[model samples]
Target: MTAELEARIELAQAVERGASVLSSRVVEAFLNVPRHPFVPAFYRRDGAKYVPTRGHNDAWLRAVYADDVLVTEVGGVHVEDAPDCGVTGVATSSSTAPGLMAEMLDALDVRPADRVWEIGTGTGYNAALLCHLAGAATVTTVDRTARLVDAAQGRLHEVGFAPAVLRADGAGTPPAGGPFDRIIATCAVRRVPTAWLEQCVTGGVIVAPIGNALGGGAVVHLTKLPDGGGGGGGGGDGPIH
Candidate 1:
């Protein structure tokens, strides 16, 4: 294999070895999904290297595999697009970095046959991973951008994985296929959306980033109370362990 490819493999392996600290399902998803495919050519031109706007490139690649989060885009623009400007577009969405995703999954504690609702389905990478764990038929993802929704849906289909993907604002609860066992938001929210709480099943989990400012990347893990109408909130801090 090429050096970059080899390095990526090693990175993935490292993440797998650390799975004891991560959710088993999340680790499996990282090993199964190819980050290279989702990364843009600008940052990934060197194969496995994750060259950021500034900083040590090698350190970034390792971070990608670790349980830490990586910002693939700023605003609506891919980081590679205008690295020098450091300007953010609108903060669309991303497949939460491998490390953060693991913690989120660990917090959710999804089980087989669990029906999942994934909001802000950016590239569909996260949805694909969830499907791999919960079964594609049990996963449904939504995005506000039609382009994003279509692209994610197409990618899932191309990979022979089928998950319900739709173009809709994630501000409200998903109507069909919910009363979900788990709900994950790939984007950020300032306040808990009552609609989301309303649709989650009793004892279900809702994992999302509760913030509006950049760099406020804390992942919030909420478990629905027995009534399925309320939740207790906690900041997720399970390291890239």
Candidate 2:
């Protein structure tokens, strides 16, 4: 690795260490998935270092390893295809930054062999991380964009990791996937979808960013109570910070 690359890695390690809310499995997943593959070529230079003329490669990598959210696509458009050099328009999808992801996972509390579902496949980066923690077969992810879904599928398979990926609306509930142990969304939702609450197992956790735009959003965590079917199950607080 180049000195810059080494520095980048060290930075990621430090962020992971400081992220007390993140779990070890989540940290490992952040370290394991290659953020370079999910990023556009312009943003990539030394594979691990950042190039400002290209994009914030180091910050993106740090976000990935920190389990935070990084916008990769916007307004149903992929970053590579967009004319703008840096992020532009509305962020429709992203490879969630590592720190935020870990925080979500730690809060969701997914365990080994637990069946988990993720909304917003994005670049499939988050799905890959989930597979690393929950096992490939135990994870299922859905995305609204067919192109994004296809691309994410290819990336995951290319890296020798596979999880059930589907093309679907982010707001819609998956088809009887299960009373999932945990459910997460890579995109922000204005409000918790009722369909998602129905699909979750009683007492299961559902995590997602609640609000519009990137800044001033709250990562809400909800627990499905035993009597959740009667509207008694869904209750939680927001802005995980």
Candidate 3:
């Protein structure tokens, strides 16, 4: 088998082992949608500085497939723009750990016809996976910065995904497409965005990391109520866990 294929298989297995839901669809998404194309270059912390690393070589490709979070930006500086000497700053954006992504995606329970709205389209890797789960044309992803939106759009197109990559604050209005079936946030928020809730369908799911703290605490699986309530919904709805 090819090295990239082997690496992706290893990644799929690793993510599968850690994920709470043993979803064959999620595993297939990992194996089919490559992580390297989304992150051509990323930052790896070395001492006090974050070093820029390119994904042109075999080792880098393997690292890309690894279940670790790859920091693609530091203090708004994309890895490709960073100096060779490196720089130290807070990670502004990153491609999340595959295991966590798998867990969250499983919680989202995206189906083929589901209209998904994704918050924080960093590197567009998650968006691509969403496309695999749902459909590319049906997925809409937004990011805070224009740079992220533009870059993510380019990379997504490179890998054959053409989701609606928009430049907007995820906390603000829900973007053009409304009444989304599934709304997911990649970043932690202080509280559920009212606009996000406004846009989601009555029985639709909203999965997000609910925490104001640094790394986030828990992921909440909320279903929109018929009365437009925050917590509970529908007769046969499951509890948010």
Alpha-carbon local distance difference test for all models: 0.66, 0.66, 0.83
Residue 169 lDDT, candidate 3, scale 0-100: 88
Comparing 2 and 3 on TM-score, the stronger one: 3
Q: Order the candidates by TM-score, highest first.
A: 3, 2, 1
lDDT of 1 at 135: 89
**Which 10-residue window in model 2 sums to the lowest lDDT?**
232-241
Best by TM-score: 3
The TM-score obtained by model 2 is 0.77
Candidate 1: deviation at residue 158, Å?
A: 2.4
Q: CA shift at 218, candidate 2, in angstroms?
A: 1.2
The residue pairs found clashing in candidate 3 are none
Model 1 Cα displacement at 17 (Å)?
6.1
Candidate 1 Cα outliers beyond 4 Å, as residue runs: 1-9, 16-20, 40-93, 236-241
Highest lDDT against the true fold, candidate: 3
Model 2 C-alpha lDDT per residue in residues 44-73, reported as the tens digit of each score: 222333222235566544443443445555
Question: Considering summed lDDT, which 10 consecutive residues are worst modelled in model 3?
Answer: 232-241
Overall local distance difference test of candidate 1: 0.66
